[model samples]
Target: MTGTLEIRGLGRNFGGLKALEDISVTLAPGEILGVIGPNGAGKTTLFNTISGVFRPSAGTVSLDGRIISRMRPDQIARLGVGRTFQSTTVFPETTVRETLERARSFLTAHSPMAWLGSFGQRAAGHSVDRVLKRIGLDGMADSEAISLAYGFQKILGIGMALVQRPRLLLMDEPAAGLNSSEKIEVTNLIRGIRDEYGIGILLVEHDMKMVMGLCDRVQVISYGRHVAIGTPEEVRTNSDVIDAYLGKDHELA
Candidate 1:
């Protein structure tokens, strides 16, 4: 599979308000694309429209050339599009292992007889183990999700998404609440996810350092309209992008 996600002339409206207008971008396998804008610029609205939280008022979204603009969220996920929200979403009472097991359930055979069979249990367990190790949570598999440090919780969120084995990951804000050290750790993890797992990532982040350092390309928006699209340096230097989003004093490097 090419694992490409393409959005064409996408737009969304809320009653009389145009939340997003004619936004378009393509994410290739293993590439990281950053989306940024000031508050109320419709970044989240765009994500919602693409991810099935809200159907678009115009245009289409496709995965590997299959039109998926009308598919439901679960249908979208089953097609290998995984996502992490802006807020933490781990089950606080569940162990790290259990959390992953729940995510693995979506891919496992769901027939009662299959679930009752030993083979199914072993398959799920194996998948969970692999994800735990990949996300650096193997040592904490038995720990309650809520008991982990905040940084670990965020990693767990990514693990939950990883268990789905997605070709494309939509990360809302991976570094939103992290300290400097935690942000660095998450940044490295994001790179590792792309380089090692070969998954395309669409990151919506406010951390300019992380965005500039990691994204292969960036699409900037303002008032729900596309303002800039280019390499990180290109967007950073664009006067319109600086004026609409990045302040005059902001540095790309």
Candidate 2:
């Protein structure tokens, strides 16, 4: 079944600081939803709450109609949710193929003994090869992850997530630190992940060009509260969104 993620009346607090307040959003199957806000708008906090890194102070998170707000991070991941950090997360010393194999191993077997078995080893290898091809890193399979260019390293992060065959992907600034050409490649890859693999995407990005071009719907937040939610064009012209986050000079055109 195509996966659906739903967050309802979610809130989070750090001591007296309310990081997120009554934030709610839904990601339907095969949809690409963008979340954007100025710094301290609670974007990362919201992601943490939904991804099970932090439990919400209030409200519930559900995946495919099952409650997941209280689940552990690994539990949520196993339930078809995958995520990438804003900062790069990769094993610098590991080869591309080895990294993907490790990710695949998580799905096939948890114990070292199980992974050492011939059947599990063969299965993980096959999955790793497929992920390498999917992320355009097949040629670099044997190369150390740290040896790749920055953009390719970011792509490898995506590949790591893909090896899990997730139903939903939460990307925190996939285009961050990327050059123009690299950003274009990432945009295409994100679209392909949604259209070809049927995975729903929830993207958090500061790059208006990518957000406006790639997202089907945009959600804007300010001071831990949702200010606007609509299509890219609608959000661009929205007075609340402009006043809260996007300035007048930030053209969506």
- Report per-prediction Cα RMSD to one decimal: 2.1, 2.2
lDDT of 1 at 88: 57
By summed lDDT, which 10 consecutive residues of candidate 1 come out lowest?
A: 106-115
Identify the runs in model 2 with alpha carbons over 4 angstroms from their true place. Answer: 85-89, 111-120
lDDT of 2 by residue, 114-145 (tens): 74688766766777787787778899899887
* Residue range 1-253, candidate 1, lDDT tens digits: 6779999999999999998999989999999999999989998898888889999999999999999999988888878889974445446688989988886775555434464778878767887898898888999999888788988988988988888778899999899889989999899999999998898999999899999999999999999999999999999889999889898666556
Question: Candidate 2 clash total?
Answer: 0
Predictions in order: lDDT? 0.88, 0.87
